[model samples]
Target: MIIVIEPDSDVPIYEQICNQIMEGIARGQIKPGHSLPSVRVFASDLGVNMHTVNKSYHLLEKKGIITIVPKSGAVISSPQDFNESSFNRLKDEFKPLIAESLVVGMTHQQIQNLVTSIIEDFTKNQK
Candidate 1:
């Protein structure tokens, strides 16, 4: 997966890195057991601080999206590991934003349709 960082964005570099890694996993571009580049290597490649990459890795681990080993580096978690309870938890975690979407004139059907389209696009890209 390619991670493009927007230097002009208000988001922090570490956050941008973390978000991209998580997005890669969500989109299946990065699969379970996939080893990420080492912190120093990624930082060098991205021209960011080593600490920034390190922080992103730790954040991913905290969210159960990756496993960080002392020397083995960070690995993506299995998609199968995201069970029904995990999905429900993620749904609950994002409930406030979803409610806000609804409040802003986004119907449930519209959101569903949008999500369906997104999934379709993602799958098509995979091939």
Candidate 2:
């Protein structure tokens, strides 16, 4: 997956890297066990500091999204099984956004459609 970072954005470079990598995994552009480029090389290519890439990789690992292997670099992890706690966490995370949508006058169908479109983007490679 190609990572493009906006240097001028308020978001940190590491976060942008982390989010893009997560989206890549969600879209199946980077599959489980796929080895990511080494920190030094990735930093050079992105014109960012090596520490930035390292921070992003470590954050991904902390979130169970990737496994960093010594000498072999980082590898994407297989998706985790969803359970009750996961569902609750998701609901908690999305609650405010859904509430905000409602306050902004988005109908239930409109919100559903928006979510469906995002899910479709992630599942496009499933087929």
* Candidate 2 runs further than 4 Å off: 81-88
lDDT (Cα, tens digit) per residue for candidate 1, span 1-127: 7999987799998899998887787677888899999999899999988998999989888778889888899988876666776688789978987888899999999988988997787677565
Q: In terms of TM-score, how similar is model 2 to the real structure?
A: 0.86
Query: lDDT of model 2 at residue 58?
Result: 96
- Give the per-residue lDDT digits (tens) of candidate 2, residues 47-122: 9999999999998887778899999989987776445765787799899999999999999999999999999988
Residue 117 shift from truth in candidate 2, angstroms: 0.6
| Residue pairs in candidate 2 whose N, alpha carbon or C atoms collide under 3 angstroms | none
TM-score of each: 0.85, 0.86
Residue 23's lDDT within candidate 1 is 73
Best by lDDT: 2
